[model samples]
Target: SQQGEEDPQALSIQEGENATMNCSYKTSINNLQWYRQNSGRGLVHLILIRSNEREKHSGRLRVTLDTSKKSSSLLITASRAADTASYFCARAPQGGSEKLVFGKGTKLTVNP
Candidate 1:
């Protein structure tokens, strides 16, 4: 089964705000990657933090991981309308194949 499943399937935030989402996985994972896709568009790789890493940051994005809990969180700070997109968290199992198994996703709306 796909390891990661993001909760709260959707979120709405005003522009210039912050949005946070959580993901939970069932099995051991080698890595977790977060991606974003605009409506009707291809997904863009946002960030990837390996199993050994606890937290990572890129631009306005902050991601945190907890292997013990098999969970992760993504925080987008000072969000903009351009940040409106669906976010997905995918996992590469520790001893499994390389292809990513993606979550259904969290649809984020940034209201201008």
Candidate 2:
């Protein structure tokens, strides 16, 4: 079974709004990463938060991890139409190899 599961399968919002997505994991992890995928395009690594880190930010993106709850969230501020994409959360196990397990993803649509 998959380790991470994202909530709210889809989201729609106007440009300039903030978008939030959540993910829950089934087991302990070394780190949690978020990725963005555009239609017909490949995935882009967004952010990665280590198990010991509570939150992290880059550009307009913010990521939070709660190991005790086995959950995480991604926040994108000042959304743009270009930000429309599918976002996934990936899990890197505590003692596993570099391979990562990914969630189903949350499709976000930013309208103009």
Q: Pick the candidate with the highest TM-score.
A: 2
TM-score (all chains, Cα) for each model: 0.96, 0.96
Backbone clashes under 3 angstroms, per model: 0, 0
**C-alpha lDDT score of every prediction, in listed order:** 0.93, 0.95
Show where candidate 1 strays beyond 4 Å: 1-3
Per-residue CA lDDT of model 1 for 5-109, tens digit only, reads 898799998999999999999988999999999999999999998999999999999999999999999999999999999999998888878688899999999
Candidate 2: tens digits of C-alpha lDDT, residues 1-112:
8669998899999999999999999889999999999999999998999999999999999999999999999999999999999999999988876789999999999999
Q: How close is candidate 1 to the true structure, as a TM-score?
A: 0.96
Model 2 per-residue lDDT at 86: 99
Candidate 1's displacement at residue 13, Å, is: 0.9
